[model samples]
Target chain A: MDKMNGAQLTIKLLERFGVDIIAGIPGGSNLPLYDALSHSTTIRHVLARHEQGAGFIAQGMARSSGRPAVCFATSGPGATNVMTALADAKLDSIPIICITGQVPQSLIGTDAFQEIDTYGMSIPITKHNFLVRSARELLEVIPAAFRIAGEGRPGPVLIDIPKDVQLEMIEFADWPAMPQRECVKHYRKQDILQAAAMINAAERPILYLGGGIRHGNAHDAAIRLAEKNNLPTTMTLLGLGSMPTNHPLALGMLGMHAARYTNLILEECDLLLVAGARFDDRATGKIAEFCPGAKVIHIDIDPGEINKLRTAHLQLVGDAGSVLAELLPQVESKNRQDWLNRMAFLKKENPFIMPGADDPCMPYGLIRQIAALADHETLIATDVGKHQMWVAQAYPFCRPRQLLTSGGLGTMGFGLPAAIGASLAHPQKTVVCFSGDGSILMNIQELATAVEQRANVKIFVLDNTSLGLVRQQQNLFFGKQYFASEYQHHVDFVTIARGFGMQAFALGASDDPVATLTKAMQTQGPCLVHVPIGRNEEVYPMVPPGAANKEMIGGENHASA
Target chain B: MQALKESYPCPPSDASGQKVLELTVNNHPGVMSHICGLFSRRAFNMEGILCMPIGDGKLSRIWIQIAGNSHLDQIVKQLEKLEDVRSAVLHPAEHEVFAKLEEYFQGS
Candidate 1:
């Protein structure tokens, strides 16, 4: 009379949560979930080579889907392997539900070979976590896991399903659809009006956009307000593509590595329009000195963010889409022609310098070519270090959540698994993971998982033969000692990907890489593109940590070391 | 009378000067998100936020500082009525301490 079994209950829950694809690696304790998954027609399982890769794929999927993605592994070692990605997801605020099969409840903490405290290990990184102690609680827990993972500014959640419990039969019940989501509230209105007045009356009003606009689908509304109110716009790295990059009003990514003109304009602006973007340390260096002369118009959906560390004059608390829809018409047009003209002058005055201009295939040039071939909705995930920053700068994104990189965490080996998640989330969309050689080696075994899953996640390796970021730092700060920075061994990521059943390619060109990337994009199944980038090249416009944004250095090509 | 009044003019001031905002919410799992998400979702500028634990671990108290309020009536109040939010109050401090901090930052 029970609903099939524990595995069936989990499968049913997965269907309910709209999980179409899962990236996982099965083992001793997790066998039952896999057994159930195999029989289930709705949810597809993609086996990863390693647990960490599986975690990243789930992360990628969750970021793109705006829903929790799933990854599975057996207890102990498998669960431990997933820790790095879980922490990475926590920092990026991606919603992924990690389901690991645990040893029988009785075997827990008995020093069993595969027995480990999976729940305790995940508690810190997960927004919420659970340990399914009984088969009877299966239905509630499955839905509960999703509820926690998907709602209220989504983040990762973990569910440790014991092997014995997973195999046991249990009754099923339909839980109510009321998502136990947290209420959304923020600053009072009388004060919000007070803030907006300063902005409307200012001579130079500039809008600094962040990821929230895309998450809220408030892009059009933002543009309407910007155009109507004569407000120029700048985007955060995550906010890239929220507004079109080519728009005359778009100021591009602004911060340490931002265009000199963007930072200059932001510095001189009289009124700063900040929306849906956190004043992360990277974005606003020397916080006190940031926007020194500007009056900030703060609008956000979360109250806690309004004044955690940054000051704003006015505040709004509502979904970006809903609030912008309401307030767009209320904006009064101001003729800030002088401001626009000055910004234009700045843009013309400071052009980015490129490294290896004459060389056929420079790293920056290669990334630009890759971008050109990339679809409007093609999802790009990058590993940590200089390659990640390069992708952030070179990729022209037009969609929200389209680019999923380890921003807050900056974890290496994050790209491939996240690519798996992104690809699984959107089977029709192209998903590319941009990783450095060193980062790829960290979880390269997952290439087998990609082969098994057939998630069509492509990878691009920027092989520079060293820990590029570390080497750069060591060169700049440590007088080029190169301690723990240089790696003598080079990885043949292309061959490795091919051996793991993926298609592979290599490129060496100075101009755009559109043609090669277009070919790669056309391929099916897992693929890897290996590009040998120069080691000395650095991501320029550094703020040197604890410095003001105005203290940025270098153009694209200035010698890093 | 129309309940929605056209509040003319966008209020302007540098809100980054930091202040305290108190929020009361039902004890719930997503309360933190509701508080944090609002800032990210609406493009609000936030600084020095502390969600110090409060009352029976059921109610949450929040302190936030911000500058702009374009959608205060339209958004903030509605959020308060959501399942989690019980009340939200923006406390304006015109005290000498706040004044002194401002003067210190201004290098006066």
Candidate 2:
């Protein structure tokens, strides 16, 4: 038996789990772990300027590779900084393991310097968290964290390693087997048959897709179900890439800001075949009135989500891929031409178009041009606000997991770090981040991380000089009395990028925006393009608060300023 | 923290307001934290919690005393969905687990 410190054993377990990269920043409490990391040749550490950036970077890798990713931080401020990302990952169900160094066990409750109850503070944010009291506990705790993080309905898990525990030496001889997770599917055979019967009988069936399809790796099953039955498909914000946007049967996203026709179709559908979706308030405006006359056939792996909100007529609790594949054999193929014709007519009668049609300097025109330049393999991420909505509305995503953005938490500054993670996960692929000026600054410190890793990520900052979403809401709902939303500073983002040792370009409102953006995307390693737009540009086709989805204010005929 | 307890929906005038939630879960390092975390995140307070390993070292049973509310049922369902949790059952407030434990502590 060989004597090894707890820190050394932790790294060995990570290696055993096939983790090659970790994003983190070191502090006083975590010096032992960093010391161990320095000795290891297998794990490459990317030093993030901030802990939150490291967390989101881990999220990006997990979302892209469909595997649990790792991040590290120290105690107190380090742990607090990573809180938002933990909450974000928990809500979005991305599998990530976060390790933070804690004070010695004896000093845990004495309020030692740089010590906060990392375990207690993390309870509300993490799916599970640990504070290792003994060196030997690492053997079980490390494996348990990984199991909880990567199992069904995956989420973020935390392990707070005390400084003394990391330094303690123990004679280690054997490694334990991984925890056993139950793979027993929970849906009854009769439920799938009943759902198929409902699908067969309904004349107008809309398949409501969600992020679970991507998590469950059920994209093929979802597309086959839609095409086999000639059913139209609609998506939640995180469900964008579940069905190819350009497919003939695909209706764009359905939500508060969804296209008018998609909402109209949802309101009229006789059966809503919901797959892997939790009926979020944003997706279902005024839940009482949403899909007023539809029988829902809900399929999800988490039994808790089956009837958490809206009760389903038939609930099938299993992996979306398995359930959909099983149900496919029971379903009989049929075409409803009258329903297809109605969809085509609605699209023709009321087309969903961006506000700016001709000028590339405008936000919509610039986003359209960028989407056109990228291929289906391109991975895109967005920060919160109007830019996120614009990209969600207009971008054409052709594959599952290609679009990674914060849907449940809607955290700002998620785009850049996430894009960096995606780029690092697949170096051969292109990753683009569409960000607002307000959001890019939230985690702007991560530009240094992207430069260090040489990640192939292109960041476009839409400088509206204000929090566009908040400004728009204030204008419509609060008599245009906007305060604190507007930025009074003259901060130059391109200068900041150049300062971080990255290639950068700043385009004026009239400068060839498309050409500059295209050049930046092709230039290589990491680059940024700044495009300024008017403050008044707002997202349209918005269903006001307390309004039904069909009562939209904008479409092709009307563009609200 | 006490304010969290006040928010629980009181039982109908005829029944006791407290209920016991029993959970069977894999005996692991951080399983307790996950259950407690769920309650903390929702701001749903539990009056008391008891945990003990079962026959073999592989599994454990947890009993939580909580005020009854509309949200309690949903909480039980979610607790059962955790990877470590095997089953979650609700018992009346008069269930013997807590009452027996109280007698043991008092006698000791």
Put down candidate 1 lDDT per residue, A343-448, tens digits, no spaces.
8887777765556543426777767777776778788888888888877776677767778877767778888777877877788888888889888888788777
Backbone collision count in every prediction? Answer: 66, 0
Instruction: State in Å the error of residue A475, model 1.
Output: 2.0
Interface DockQ of candidate 1: 0.04
Worst 10 residues of 1 chain A by lDDT: A175-184
Q: Write the per-residue lDDT of candidate 2 for residues A74-155, one digit (tens) a residue.
A: 9999999998999999989899999999998888889899999888788777777788888899999998888888777788
What is the iRMSD in Å for candidate 2? Answer: 10.1
- Per-residue CA lDDT of candidate 1, range B60-83, in tens? 776665544334433444345233
Tell me, per candidate, how large a share of the native contacts it keeps: 0.00, 0.43
Error of 2 at A253 (Å): 1.0
CAPRI-wise, candidate 2 is acceptable
